[model samples]
Target: MSRDITAVFRPDPSSPNNNTFTNITPNSGYCQPIPANCNESGRRFSSFRLPIIFRSTAAIQAGHVDPRQGAMYQVPASWRAVQVANARTGETATLEIRWAGMGSQYNLYTSAVELVGGGVTPHVAHQRLWGGSEWINAPAPCRDGRLGHFNNTIYTFFWHTSAEGTCAKRASYQIPDLYFPFLDFGYELRTPDPLMMSSGQYTGSLTYTVGPGQDVDMGDVLLPNDSAITLHFNLDVDHTLKVDVPPGGNRVELAPQEGWQAWLNSGQKPTRLFRDQRFHISASSRFKMALECQAISGDTCAIFDAGTGHAVSVDVSVSLPNGITDPAGQPVSRRRLLRDGSGTELFQAGSFVDRGMGTLHFEVGRERLAEMLDNGGNRYTGNVTVIWDSEV
Candidate 1:
């Protein structure tokens, strides 16, 4: 059987602390990753649920699938790798996941079954590894993690394991044929950084056999209704590329860096006319930037004087915040933005940048400034649009 599993990630402004994906996949029972249960495996492991149930090959009236005697399992606990490709870009990333904990519901054949340490009718307790002090409360069969919420038809138990080997737990009574109508599980995922991945759905599939001497092994007697299960994963990323321009910030006037003071005081000729337009940006995805200009000179945007018919090349460059980087993984510092979209194809984020300050430099160079100065008493004006697109 094939099942779908999904997770989503988007930049959160208020909670702009770390980068992580939230699992939106539905689960059976309370089979999520609990803090106490994941302490041993560190913070890298998570969990999910599977819709699967095991049935007995033959019905046993009153017996237990004892650990030392019969019950054996080899869960898909070790890391399994899969390649996920973006739905748009065709770029692939590796996604690794493993089963950390497995829980199930064992249905009761009859209501009068006896539990080892459970006195109540619907017994709920941790599975004992052996008969002595080797029970729950000590080092459990989950050698690397701990047990979480437990539930079955008659007896409720939880289990976790990190080591790559077979793990077994006996039934106080028969672990009912109708167990795991839905299996609660925990898993550790080694996913590619969302910052490095393109903005789209990255999809992949992982399938495991469910039988004796297989991935979800239930040993010799207890058989599963399904022979195999395919878990189809869809990890979607919704990127944020918001640019907030200050009020009246659209009109840019360029007239030398230190203003026209040098020319006004000593009759000195200014080298360049420039203005730094500041903007605040919040971005969490790969984006490309380009300029759309009303007037263009060569490959750069230009400002034109309608009366004098004089057009001067206005060079535009950008400087992003600390967390943003250019295509070469260097911090974006005065990177040139051309009309042809050359040096700004893919500006990536090293971290989530929320309302980070950036600069747009508009400059009339020495040559261009000289032409504008030569044609005196003329106002230069033109519209320039800077486009930041997230569909890169």
Candidate 2:
């Protein structure tokens, strides 16, 4: 969207008849001759003018031009706020604002043209007007100005000097001395949360002001204007899931007992497998998790006596604490290792919740180790596979 704030320069009201005001029409074309009325010798004044052009960075990159052609150059405008809806909550999501284009500098100048001049005389003074606390003369060629940030918004104003010199040797000039006629800026929004954001339309607005520099405000002669720019954002959520276990590995060792009674009297205990298991999941909608386990080798869990050629199959069960839960305070029930079937659900949450980090506690138990010893057990090793699944 583009907004035009035209500036009219006229003689001060105290001396209204001293010099006639001339209105310069802003457009996309090259420089034109100054109005004949601006040639009076008396001190003339110019009112500040600012035209703001707002557009998305994408549109600017695509070379979208303003239909009005108010400014010679076209640039993208920065955003004030970008909102996204959390996938789980379907409401406004947390975000961080990042601005771009502040401190970017651009040159303001009039079109260069050759004027009729005798071989011994210069046609027009080579000069440029620059922006400062007030308008000031700059080295010929062009003047530089930068976009500034304040109160969460970007602002800039322009200064103007009427064209000067004889008709036969007229100088091309910028009506509003220094302005951001073709300035472009933009920003990006980001979040660290794991919850995905919904894909949809979002809207916002930014307010800014334009006026003369500090030195140019002669007793309110140069008034400022406040304007609002609307903003829009379309967000999309990405489904993500991750699970990790300790690096060293989950292992348990059992020593053979002298007899069944001795093994029973020893009071064998289940060893804790992994210190902690971690999982992160995000989805555009609702999600659930399940866990399953199976013996790595043959159908039965067993250990063999190499010398006696005998094997003892043992039942291994995994125990978990029923109190495990997610960041959102949703509980995950205790689950037992399953050799078959669909497995057990760990936890489930609706679209309104976001689960950050999840932890799992596991205990490996050897049932009836003494009974296995009676069958002539030897040193044995086996593997179990644990699977974690997430569905959206």
Candidate 3:
């Protein structure tokens, strides 16, 4: 019974220790056993921090990501310089996202991508997820009230991820050209009238926006900041002219032969012949009318002597209404006479503004008839001709 017994658990100095141990330290004043790395663990507990990173893909030649500002992105001029030549329908320009750290750890959280401010229209926007072998269509997200609108459109795409490791997502934004309706003179350019006049050179502009859906400080990614493009074109018009003579009052009736003979024998003056006429004209340019004479006998008015065969000359005069103008607005003379075979100008128009309906009063008179009767009472006849001319 003799010696006091002591119990202790200790590892042998040469033996390999495999058992686990815990420090059963008391909260108040009692001596406690500390672990080997206690100070290191305490320091780490006070200074622990997690990193978050968002970045553009290596394939992106022109755009950059700002990790400090909520991963905001921009494409400067150098990036914009990369041109898309005649981008086709269904063709797309990709904006990719590469993320690591805590930001990429959302197992069920949803993120959205959007486009705004560009002339592009009727385009398709969607997201793709990385499958083991290929990209697969991800479930598109419904519209979220938080995103609001962009470029007057609510175009948005939502995506979800379940993996917590590094993830890469992409938005394929279809680049489709925009078109506008154009009209001239109430007619489309496709079926324009051939006779329509030209409106000359024309210039116009179109505005557009293209960017992410969120209303952030970042500008449009695919277009200029101004978002306005100029349109230049010219309207071509053709020149045209139309001329017509109205009927029903266009004929002139000369005095009867007996009446003229009685007047010649009695020394009474012959009655002058008169006619009222109208001409309809439509033109886009200047125009005119020329007159000439064709003599069947010796002159426009000549009597052939049956016995001596001597020709007797008679004078004829033609007159039109004074103050009358042609479609071109030029004044037409009231009187003109046939001289030689070359025709003389009877009417003229100077401007397109002056073209339209016109009227003319014609009067024909004969002189030196008594001289024709004295040369042996022979009959004579001639013809008068008129021509209309225009710039086209």
The numbered model that scores best in TM-score is 1
Worst 10 contiguous positions by lDDT, candidate 1: 129-138
Candidate 1 vs candidate 3: the lDDT winner is: 1
Give per-residue CA lDDT, model 2, range 1-392, as digits (tens): 33222222222324322221132323221111222222225422221122342222111111213322121221122223434454454567443333221122222232212111213212121221111121122211213222122211122322122221110111133322222333222222343232322233222333333322221111112132323333333333333333444454355444432323544687643322223344443322223433333323233344445666554443333332232334455554443344442234333332322234444443323444444455565654445455444432
Residue 179 lDDT (model 3)? 13
- The lDDT-based order of candidates, best leading, equals 1, 2, 3
Residues 267-346 of candidate 1 have per-residue lDDT tens digits of 78899989999999998878899999999887788888899788888889999998889887899988898888998999
**Model 1 CA RMSD to the hidden true structure, in angstroms:** 4.8
In model 1, what lDDT does residue 101 have? Answer: 69
Q: Against the correct fold, how does model 3 do in TM-score?
A: 0.32
The C-alpha stretches of model 2 lying farther than 4 A from their native spots are 1-181, 186-192, 195-261, 264-290, 295-383, 388-392
All candidates: TM-score: 0.80, 0.31, 0.32
